[model samples]
Target: MAFELPPPLAELRTRVRAFVDDAVIPAEKAILEEDREKKRDTLNALRERTRAEGLFVPHLPKEHGGLGLGIMGMCALFREMGRSPVGAACFNCDAPDQGNMDLLLKAAAPAVRERWLAPLARGEITSGFAMTEPAPGAGADPSNLKTRATKVDGGWLIDGHKWYTTGGGDASFLIVMARTSDDPRTGATMFVVDRQADGVEHVRDVPVMSPPILQHREAELRFNSVRIGDDAVLGGVGEGFRLAQARLVPARLTHCMRWLGWADRALHMCREYVLTRESFGKTLAHHQMIQKKIADAVSGIHAGNLMTIHCASMLEQGLDKEARPYSSMAKNHVARLLCQILDDAIQMHGSLGYSEDMPFSLWYRFARSARIADGPDEVHDVVVARDFLRGALTTLV
Candidate 1:
């Protein structure tokens, strides 16, 4: 019955909108203009302003100097932030960092927190979560993990190769998944390896479509006899799988929520173009086909937003097990839908959307990877189907 946000949340959304329009949008233009060398500098300057506005780290707890907002509130803020691709990154709520921060807060030791989490929370240094590996490694299957952490005097020695490590190149610390027990029956365990540690090498930065990134630096990590203390274990031995899942659920939801705003912004751009651009004797908006496309774009965005909000609300209520199925559905659905919506918006823009002069083309490029990046749409679909069969589906449906 109550579909509208509460008064405080409504006010928060308005403020977020204003901040994004007045601040984030302008910064995006500057980012688009900057060369690869200058983008990081421009981004840092913009982030300083976001920090001053107290808009950074909305999901972090209050004790850690965050807004300490609930999931619904975070979803609202993230959607607004996602309106600009740089907004989430600027506010220190971007992926890898967002997920990394959540892990530290939830399960990391206080000593580990002192060494790494505090700096991360303050946005002083970057971090990465390395789970995916190349072929013959852990790609898409935790059970296929080939990375091994052999027991040795004082610490564990790590040896393996990883790719698509989203922020690995810039990360001061990496949460790595490796096999500690020899049975090969138990899933891989996770360890926190400092970036400067011996045998940890940054192969190279894999170029991606997103811009203004300090760590589009998804690199290949080679660990040959890399060492860390027994304290390096995150959570507990054999518990890495659980910890990884915990971090991923919220991470995927946040991604879906943020990208929904990006798609909304793209749709708005398409709508404005249609209303202004003339075709034959009339504006593009006058065409029935254009109207249908615009309608679908809006509908897709609404559906994605609804799914994200529902998941967020459930999470705030601590209904997480019930929420996981929805999170996967949302991540998979929204990621794919976002790509579709962006494609439609591009079609609506004609050649302009496909051109590098506009962010539309870049968004189209970035959108394609979303489905694959977060556990692929196929994986989420399987989870959803299994849940549906188990009769565990919830109000998020």
Candidate 2:
């Protein structure tokens, strides 16, 4: 199936690209070293401006004060938002909030929607997804989950330790995955735990190799008898893994889309540099070596974008199960390409690209994490291999 954006979505994409280039990218320069509170304030101000421009929450339903764009539309728009490190946040569409919003919209009950999803969609608060845990617990395999949710008289008591919980420090709440039964296939359940709850403790932000603004601020969470009502269970008792997979597939592809934009921008910077910079009595652009890097980067980016849109189309057509293999392939392929493109750009610029004077260094550091986040390359490789063995190789064809 053709994945071309319709005329309206094409227009929206252009508008978002212009806004990101003119507003978001310029604002990002000022907030690179801003304090946490100041960062929040600056992003909030940008969100207001984005709303005024009628581009806020463009992926959510129109009933939720968004533009009601589907997955295909999001694929196009998110790439523009990725042009700036903070572009997605400025438009109220950054993760883990963006992924959380998608989950709540599909899984939350009416009351839960009113209490949590409404504010999230409006960008009134931030949220986190807590699934990964320390060793001896769940990491790549959810079946090994160690977090427990024991039923009590009133509701449930959740006790566990989760590391790499993205945005946990500043989130108003977290969607926590806890084991509630003995069945490995259906033991885990998702609970909505408030950040201010008595038993919820934030240990520290795990250090990562990424730009300060782009770093996910991975939090170590300790849930000690965190009490919550029956209302907190999301998508019912045994659907944690199922629901998480739903969130992850799209989340992975969106990451690809945004990183694609960042890589594209880096390539553009490299092209400009090569054309203007002289080397050995000739412009760098005239060098065959430099031209090869540019050509490869462009070709890789085109392939990555195609894979991203193909995955988006699968999700849009309600084929999440069928899309898993493609999702893994795209995530692994595009994430690697993102790093390679940034590396090429840095190499072409020599010392300047490696320095803080340019954004290539920052983009390189951030793109490195894309390979590990939302499932690492190794895991995705296993997924692709397994799918091939099962004869679900149509996606590859």
- All candidates: TM-score: 0.94, 0.97
**lDDT, candidate 2, at 275:** 96
State the lDDT of candidate 2 residue by residue for 170-191, as single tens digits: 8899999999998978899998
> Which window of ten consecutive residues has the lowest lDDT sum in model 2?
30-39
Tens digits of per-residue lDDT, candidate 1, 11-116, equal 8788778888987788776765663563466777877877787777878988887888887788878888889877887788888988888888777777887899
Runs in model 1 lying further than 4 Å from the true structure? 32-35, 182-186, 208-212, 394-397
Q: Rate the local accuracy (lDDT) of all candidates.
A: 0.82, 0.87
| Clashes per model (N, Cα, C within 3 A) | 0, 0
- Candidate 1 has what TM-score? 0.94
Pairs with steric clashes in candidate 1: none
